[model samples]
Target: MLPALALAVAVTVTAPPAAHARTGPAPSAAKASKTAKFPPGFLWGVATSGFQGEGSFPDSNWTRYVKRKATGISDPYEKSVDFLHRYPGDIKLARNLGANVFRTSIEWARIEPRPGVRDPKAIAYYDDLIRRIRAAGMRPMITLDHWVYPGWVADQGAWDNPKTQADWLRNARFIVDRYKHQGVIWITFNEASAYMYKELTMRPMDLGQLAAMRTAIVKTHRAAYDMIHKIDPGAPVSTNVAYGTALNGIFDAALFNEVTDKIDFIGIDYYYGANAENLTAGYALTGEFWKIDPEPEGLYYVLKSYQRRLPKLPVYVVENGMSTDNGKPRPDGYTRSDHLRDHIYWIQRAMADGVKMIGYNYWSLTDNYEWGSYRPRFGLYTVDALTDPSLARRPTDAVATYRSIIANRGVPSGYVPVRRPGWCSVEDPVATCFGTTPTPPAAYRIPAR
Candidate 1:
């Protein structure tokens, strides 16, 4: 997930040439017909992380970070959504969406609060969580690390310490051995680049320390991939990348490139997009994600780019969603339902164009603590983690839209996007705008319902 804090990293923006203007009529109904169906057995799911969604967090780097009153956290981390206790009901909510997958992470801090000490209670909690997810007829996609480490680990310099690799592997082996029989898909790391960036944001790191942390992340992912496969043969494992628009190649080179041979699938987490006409992604610099315009059509280009690079591996959209300010209506009048449908439309288009797309998990099931703030809401069911006493999971407009999409395996046949494709998308400017990329079926906009 993109960090909900000011990002110091610079984005490389490429200005498209003037000749790339969108032209031509909408594709014939015959061409657009292919966008209505998905391949059989595509996984549909919702995603949440241990630190972000599951509250009652154990002693970890994040818990410690939030404790610093100057972090500018919008709301105190008060048992965020309390998924630690409310997971049963949450699982039922996901199952109701007709989803076949449920993605989440195991809190390393909770499981191993001390060096070499394993918490039985934490193990039991995760065991029941996985069992309940399976009972609800959804496959569990478990992430080994979601950017939080045991406070003890932090006391010893976190990932900058060379010994941390062994500790991380030990935890990975334990989790894999315990859950291998639960039919769980494994995610070795979540948004490794973003993880590194978040670490830098919290505390400045020297170049050597940054290098050490990067090496640790790469080595551990490669090691974890092998260990997971050995424990659960044929199990799929990947480290999802937070898709960085024009700098994707450079950002991925840090960790993703090192373990290309190890990943079973290409996991991508795409949110905002940039182009000549749309540059609102800058809002994320100040953690104002809701102000960023979502370019759903850019998903098609992102998938295409990955398919070109690693044609053998299937692509799974591990996270994708639009945020709203405190669950309020968007100024652009773009509802969650509209955003969901538009993104799915592009996914289908990508599949139709022969990208080996396998699955897509919405960013979250309910609004939880987004790194440091509760202001950027990205959930099908909105929960007021800061203001509401009961922490109710109020269904957003996207709930029914998602249920319908899953039931039919895609959007309705004649449905058109509420938002038109942006001109000269930075996701893949050369291919999407300049190169001989075939023109997309021209969009026919319909009033958002």
Candidate 2:
């Protein structure tokens, strides 16, 4: 299976760049205001993941994936951002920037390292993390799953087996019961559909394997949703799904239709590019990440698509930022400041068009693993994990710019975003703003008469 997956990874890595690329805690932070009028409630937060940012945890599937030769991720999962120890430092950094919410995930693999045994130490770690959230005056948004699972569970049956859903429910119930008092945002799963296919596509899976994965994902999400509400009836639960280009949205729809009745809110994650060929209902998307370049106008199109369908629920720029291979200025002498400023301009335009929008969370405060390498840097505070020894976090030009945006409540009227907004490629990839280059839709074919 892994050898075949290695071949798949080789294929994707070799493919043309199409498109690419959440959280923790309240130091304590929801509704964003409407156009011109901010919502009655607004959520301002930064996001992280336990497996990605938390260091010093025991081995899990991702840990193995990172270490494996085919997976290609470096550094072997040691002391990632040292957030396990220095989250306070990062949380403090977010607080200083005027953020009102901190988002992070609970690693099930860590919380339930062994099948039946719960880790007391892991529970304590999260207890401390939640307490810190309340202390920081930020609301906590806890994600139940963020694409990492226990190595043991993987051994038993990943999503391909029926038992995985039951196992997941056990863990979900434990989490909701344990953290009920946090009054936090409950995210049942983070980009489940996206991860499932990406993982399978990463390895190669037959239709039967694909069917099992899809079935298990929907069932698992539904089970977890019920568990969250059953344990804490009032807790608002949602699933944060990746709302990417056509390909990503199609993959993210698994839980949307199957478990629509089980959620309080649907969290949609939107990143770079402006193509709207494949949005699904019941699951509203949060602009996960957007930049001024490569696809600045794509951000505008993203909000516009939501306005057309998800107009009532305010949009949250859940994640958005830029990545420089070498921390250099943007192509047009655009600094990080230009990138953010430009994206905000389209955000304002979206607001004018009556998009119920709320908060905007930066992609990250510091750079970590870009899945495989340190080359793809995306943080307001840059970490030299690849080149710098101190692992120190340093601010970029956008740090001050973001502080100003949070303080001012919006970008200035005269402030020009780095680029102009462009048309959305609903059924065409090459029809995008930055995508003026014509590439036919992947699924294009003539229908029978």
Candidate 3:
């Protein structure tokens, strides 16, 4: 989940008009044709986090936080989708999607439920999970940490504690050494920026504590990156950044700039887009993600920005998806299939524009506890986590669309995004609003409604 407060801050900051003056015409139709197809072996995958998708709650900071009535969570964390016991069936759903990569986090809380003791049962569970993923013909992309930590860490002042860095690296090194030979892609931390924002929201903290936490997070990631490379040698590792609108650079610089040399690739999670006219994004602050319009075209600008910043590193859309409130139909009638295709269309455009994009993962495989609520469903398969005791995984409209996409490598040759690019999109003001208007091939444009 992205921090809506960050988006609110981005809305107030705008680039100067002259800073992005167009110097030439947009790409020609002929150029688009040359890059319509995805390169061979592009990674098509689904993403889930340990705490968000997995059920059977363990003692963790999040579990404790949600217990407080003041948190105002819409629902209780009732064995969320029960992924702890049902991973095999979920893995089957991803396999049926033709996915080559299955991304999930190794829960620090579960692995080390206590201060220093490691649970063998937790280790065995993840061992089998990775084995199944590999046997099903997919590589496992493991996230070492995804915001939730052992309750012991929280009791010790969480990231603000100076001891937290060593403790984090201890668990991280163990996980890396255990799975180093398993053909795994590693993510050191999930949305490091959002994690910090969540800390601010979940609890009251002074600026000094926040700064300490930031420093500790950077040090922990740097150490973890070094340790993973030392153990695995050539495996790719990154800490994904949640893409904030105009404040993206600022938010990313908080941690990314500190360890730019440590990253093997750039992992980005993009959801909503904001522009001068698109104030609807404010709804995300209140957990109303569906009300915010989907802006698939903004993904193109996001990729282009990163390509310009880090020309050599491969970029991956580590997580991207739209959320509907409690699986309800969006008022705009934009189905999940439409959102998936439109986002892929923009990704193809980014690739055409020379961005070194290598992989894309839908946000999740099934609906689970999205932070504090199950209301925001961002899954290819919807699961009634609160109501259904069976916790059945029902396919949404995106299932067939994703299966065909992975099998075909991308959307068809003449595909255009269902959602057109907004005027002066804040995603990359210099590239969009202030610069030359991007024009798709005439064959790809759909008539305005």
Top candidate, metric TM-score: 3
Instruction: Compose the digit string of candidate 2's lDDT tens values, residues 1-449.
Output: 34323323423312232232100110000112122423445676677778777777676767767667333444555776677787778888888888787778899898988889889988898899988887988888888888888988878867777788888888888888888867688887777655664455443456567666666777777777777777787877777656555444444444554565666654656555533432321121211122223445456556665445444454666667777765665445656776676666667766665666766667777776655456566888888775666778899988898888777767765443344333434323333423432222332121000
After superposition, the stretches of candidate 1 with alpha carbons farther than 4 Å from their true spots are: 1-33, 70-72, 435-449
- Give per-model TM-scores: 0.91, 0.79, 0.91
Task: Give the per-residue lDDT of model 3 (tens digit) for 146-235.
Answer: 889988998898987888899989999889999988889999888876777777678645556666677788888888888888999889
lDDT of 1 by residue, 99-184 (tens): 98999999889999988899999999999999999999989999999998999999998888888999999998999999887778
Candidate 3 structure, TM-score to reference: 0.91
| Residue 6 miss distance in model 2 (angstroms) | 15
Pairs clashing within candidate 1: none
Q: Is candidate 2 or candidate 3 better by lDDT?
A: 3
How big is the positional error of residue 337 in model 3, measured in Å on the Cα after superposition?
Answer: 0.7
Winning candidate number (lDDT): 1
